[model samples]
Target: MIHHAGLIAAFMDGGWRGALIQGPSGAGKSDLALRCLDSGFALVADDRVELWTSGGRLYGRAPETLAGRIEVRGIDVLPAPALAWARVSLCVRAGTPERIPEPAFTDDFGLRLPLLTLALLESSAPAKLSRALRHLGERR
Candidate 1:
């Protein structure tokens, strides 16, 4: 089991999959999620997500209490479309990463996943994430 300070968003083009978005509190985790949703991603978990490894792949799910809900910053909690689980294909760190090292990887529940970083507040972030997902899907 792995509890992380992040939210997970699942996107489906032909298959359902997800990315684990991690960062310090107020790092715009949920805000990034909202943008992703607008850009065609679905929520897997918000604020807190439960992660586990299954047959060598990492999966993410929302805790029961947080299911289908997301905090919109100063806005009230809102109901959103959500998936019970999804195989995590990547991990996204929301921040001004000092410097992006060469290909990065992060471990969760004993599984390693490709990691990427982005400035979540940027207007183009959601579009950037969507493109990254498309690129990843093509590679896999």
Candidate 2:
């Protein structure tokens, strides 16, 4: 299925795991993604993501037309380094995040992805996501 989401992949354990960013327009999804990229994550898809299920896990990628491209709100659509696809490990919803929220999950293709709410524009958002991914890795 195609979704209005942005996908960014973080390198971990010699592989890439995607974080699916979802929110309404102007919710800073792309902005968050750019920050993630600047922080060493790879772009999978920006603005729209194609999702599928395989081996009990959800995976995401960019559509052919949008591959290797990301839209920067104030700037032109720019080319970026991207992966063909990635196993999704997390879902981030742009919003007013709780200071210490309960654990949450979001279902996609019957697979539940660990969920985190973040104020995407905050300078610390990318670091928070990196920490969350590390915590999730520790738990597994």
Candidate 3:
């Protein structure tokens, strides 16, 4: 299924793990993704993501027309280095995250992914996400 979301992939363990960012328009999905990119993450998809199950794992990618392009609001849609696809390891919802969030997960194609609610525009968001991914890796 294709969703209105931005996908960014962080290289880990010799491969890429995707973080699917979901939110309403102008909710900082793209902005957060841009920050993630600045922090060494790769863009998997922008604006729209095509998700599917392969060998029981959920994966996602950009649609053909939008591949390698990221929208910078009030700026041009610029080209960037991107991955063809990534195995989704986390799901981030743009919102006011709880100070101490309990364990949460979201299901896609019957696969469950760790969920993190974030205030996307925060200066520390990308760092928080990186830390969360590291914690997630430790648990797996």
Candidate 4:
């Protein structure tokens, strides 16, 4: 079976396989996830995603505990849109200082996936997330 690391934020509506947003705590991972959701992406799991391997493909599901709860800072915990099960296709690590240089690709268990490192900027995160996801889809 596919073994997953810690928490993962996956998208469900854009494609069959989703992107796993990973990073150290307080790196805005959840914030990015929220932005992605606002940009038409479904939340698979906010803080936990179950990973499994089948037929050489890796899939993920939302953990029951944090399934619908998405933290919105001052807004209190909110329920995200219903999630869709999906296979994980990409893993993005959060950058310190809120931003990182635009990355090209990153390695995951020896496999390479395109990178869209977060550069901490006050710009529209949702729009940026949408653009990045669209780019990712176009690449495949």
TM-score of each: 0.87, 0.95, 0.95, 0.69
How many clashes does each candidate structure show, in the order listed?
0, 0, 0, 5
Better of 2 and 3 by lDDT: 3
Instruction: Rank all candidate structures by their lDDT, best first, as comma-separated numbers.
Output: 3, 2, 1, 4
Score candidate 2 by TM-score against the native: 0.95
Across residues 17-92, which tens digit of lDDT does each residue of candidate 4 receive?
Answer: 4777666666676777776665567777766667766665556777677666777866887876655566666665
Q: lDDT tens string, model 2, 13-131?
A: 78787888999999999999999999999999999999999888888999999999999998899999999999888888899998788888777558777898989999999999888
The pairs that clash in candidate 1 are: none
Question: Between candidates 1 and 2, which one is better according to lDDT?
Answer: 2
Error of 3 at 120 (Å): 0.6
Answer with 1 or 2, whichever has the higher TM-score: 2
Question: What is candidate 3's lDDT per residue for 1-140, written digit by digit as tens?
Answer: 99999999888878887888999999999999999999999999999999998886888999999999999999989998999999888889999989998988887558777888999999999999988877764554
Candidate 3 residue spans exceeding 4 A from truth = none
The lDDT of each candidate is 0.78, 0.89, 0.89, 0.59
lDDT of 4 at 109: 46
Our model 1 lands, by Cα RMSD against the true structure, at: 2.2
lDDT of 1 by residue, 105-132 (tens): 7764576677778898889888877776
Off by over 4 Å in 1: 10-13, 97-101, 137-140
